[model samples]
Target chain A: MVPLLEFRNVAVDAAGSEPIEGVSFAIAAGENAVFFGVEGSGLKTVAPLVLGLEEPSGGDVLHRGGTIRGLDYLERLRYKNAIGYLHGDYGLISSLTVEQNISLRLEYYSEYLPEEITAITERLMAELRIIDKRTARPVQLTRSEIFRTAYARAVVHDPELLIIEFAFVDQSPLNIRSFMDVLKARGADPAKSVIFMTYEPQKFVDFADTFIMLYNGRIVFSGSRQDFFDSDNPYLVQYRSTSLRGPMAIS
Target chain B: MMDDERKTTPSGGSVAAYVGAPLLRVWRGTVDFAAYVVSIVLSFRSLRFIRLRSISATILTQTRFTGIDALPFVIVIAVLVGGVVIIQGMTNLPRFGIEGYFSNLMVIIIARELGPLVTALIVITRSGTAIATEIATQKWSREILALEIAGIDPRLYIVIPRIVAFSLSIFSLIIFFDTAAFLGGYLISLATLYMPVGAFFGNLSQAFSMKDLLATIVKSMMFGVLIPLISYYYGMMPRSKSEIPIYVSRAVSRTLFTIIVLNVLVSALLYFSWLE
Candidate 1:
């Protein structure tokens, strides 16, 4: 079967001097892949480029085997209608309430009125298990709560591919595991094409069907979780031990 | 995929190499201003109701963003200016025993030129900066794209209300400022020089024609559009994040300078054309 997504020698110059170079990868439908990289390694840039928010200085982002430009705005919207992208910072609308934010995608895509929105809101609230905090805004929520709400909004339309930037705050191993289980139960398939980006591998190594390590803007390693773990590679060891304090922590 | 496609920036694209950028920016700014005018003009048709959204946004922006918030400052400036001008005229004119000329100077120059000019400058500093900064932040945050992705146009949702709001607000403030200035002149004339209230009003009414009032309103309205348009134009003009604040400052400064220069030019033209 054809891969759901593919990247070929995707070099990009987001800033003139810093070029993200020589990257090629692919993920089949229902295959979960994670990019292990430090900050400024170009992993974060990939999703924005794929989402068509940024233009690549070189290389095309192909969706369903066609270059992104092949589809017009409305057409692209239709394609993205079923794709969920959870940006690293949880890109929540601060002005909107939790329920309103969750239903924002529905309202934007479907133009659902009050009653229809309420119906979707109820279903999504129940699915995400955050029905009690539906009235809270993004600023009012804890990091974990924000994650759940962002995840719920991302999947509200039942997207085929869920692109999540794996984020963990000051949570214990148990809380992290519980949240992972909740995410898995809510429909994130580890074997599917759910391109996840993270700095910490121990928290997400089990979830990756394939691990692609990006270092200094290049894909340095691509292998199974066991191969990545068992290898005594110095780079992998260094990457595995690093912690992600989250986007806001970055200067 | 996007990867195999080679790309290169055009050669000699340095800031200095792009000498025509300023000209291009001016042309683009003019085109933008004209487009707004055309849209406003064509808004009479049923197909143009969408334009009304922009109009409504501009009106609302001018009201909330420009007018009501600016009242205190405008009043203080106008009053002080009026008192100063009257005091200067009263003191100096008495030397020639032509103290009556104070009313004439107060009525014509204050009502016609100083009133609108000062008010516009105040707005360009306050509301104008606010609008530019807000738009600049929106551009930086990718919230602009968020609006576009959500199928909402940023110009209508963000810009139009401000244009409308500043226009009405500026005009309203100009009128208020001129009225306050007149009151200030009267108080100075009454308490110090013992000029009667009726005499001051009579001289003001005689010197200030319906044409003067109409022309003043027109000039203030023009200024309302000019300042916001310049601010919006320059603020939205830059593509790079680093250049946005620079452009906003340039827009505000240029707008204030234009208000002063245009005030002089229009006043001179009006004076020569009418008083001749």
Candidate 2:
């Protein structure tokens, strides 16, 4: 299968220093991949490459075999419309209400019919349990509610690939779990792909069909969840341990 | 991925290089800012515009703040300015017993100068702060990047509506201010002195040239664009919350300075070419 997104030996100079060195990874269609690492491990830095917002210093970022960096203006717009990205802080537009914020993607791209827009709004609000808070602005929402709002906005278009960052940190675990479950279910459809990134992965580990672990700018593991859990790799072992003092955490 | 892309900065030990570094930085910044403003202007070339529905929604929302909410302040200032001009005229012109000339003098001062200048300042104080703070907050929050990722150009959704709204609002306010000031001055005259309203009207009618009206409007519209664009430029500069307030302060001061400089320059040109 052609992967939905692939990074080929990508070396990125993050903040004037090369923190992502020769990292290679591929996420095929329908695979919900989780990437986690300690600070400076470069997991959070991967989204910009896939989003075509950044170009790799050394290697290519490809979307279904075509170079992401090569796509022109209109093409890039279309490509981005088909993919959804959720930042660590739930990148909601402050000026827009919760519903306007969610519908913004559809309305901005000029893609939805009035009724289709109404239907999608209803469905996402119901699913995300934000029906009551639809008119409330981003500032009015609680932390958990904002998570739901961000989730609704990201998936409002049924995007082909969704890149989510900090999916579980500071979130109510139940809410994160439910959101992850929905994403996992969506990922079972052959047309969709998910790349989830986080600093703390243990709480949301159950959502990963495939797991990729980064250690000091290099991918130490990229494979099935079963394989990752079974491995006795020092880094994996340290990461899996729940103890306060572990090599997985920054010293 | 972007981090890999490199930028070369100029640095050297030679005497010329030592003197030129700051100058070089300023030159580069000027070019970059010109390019940014031009790019924003170019985005309006209809062929490149985003959905009209999006633009329409944005324009309406922007007008609410720049026009509707600004009406009260515009009115108060207009009335006060008009009264001040008449008060000055009433006290001074009666020595020559040419108090009838108050209408003509008020027309010149209020329409040709004060109308556009005051309107621009009010907008800079009100809409300019809001726009600068809004964009700066958005930039600080990474919401602009979020918009880009969502397939919306921030210029399309953010900047263009403001430019159009400010221009339209200032033009309207200039007309409104002129009307209010005239009526305000006339009311003051009626209360203070037994002047004939018809004669007052006749004097103003005689003095009201299309050139002065045109100059007032052109300045207001130009100022409308300048104020918002300056605010946006400064507002979009900072990446962190700590830097946003500083940018907001800088946006207001720089916007005021630019408006004053441009107002004088344009007025001088108009004086030479038309108003003289």
Number of the top-ranking candidate, with TM-score as the measure: 2
Candidate 1 at A211: error in angstroms? 3.4
Candidate 1 C-alpha lDDT tens digits along B196-258: 788777887888777677768678777866776677667676688888889889888888877
Kindly report the TM-score of the first chain in candidate 1.
0.84
Q: Model 1 compared with the native: what TM-score? A: 0.67
Specify the CAPRI tier of model 2. Answer: medium
lDDT of 1: 0.70
lDDT of 2 by residue, A156-218 (tens): 888889888875568777765566667668767777887788766654456667888998889
What stretches of model 1 exceed 4 Å from their correct place?
Answer: A1-4, A13-31, A38-41, A70-84, A89-110, A114-162, A166-186, A189-193, A205-210, A215-251, B1-62, B86-107, B132-157, B184-188, B193-251, B262-276
Q: What is the CAPRI rating of model 1's predicted complex?
A: incorrect
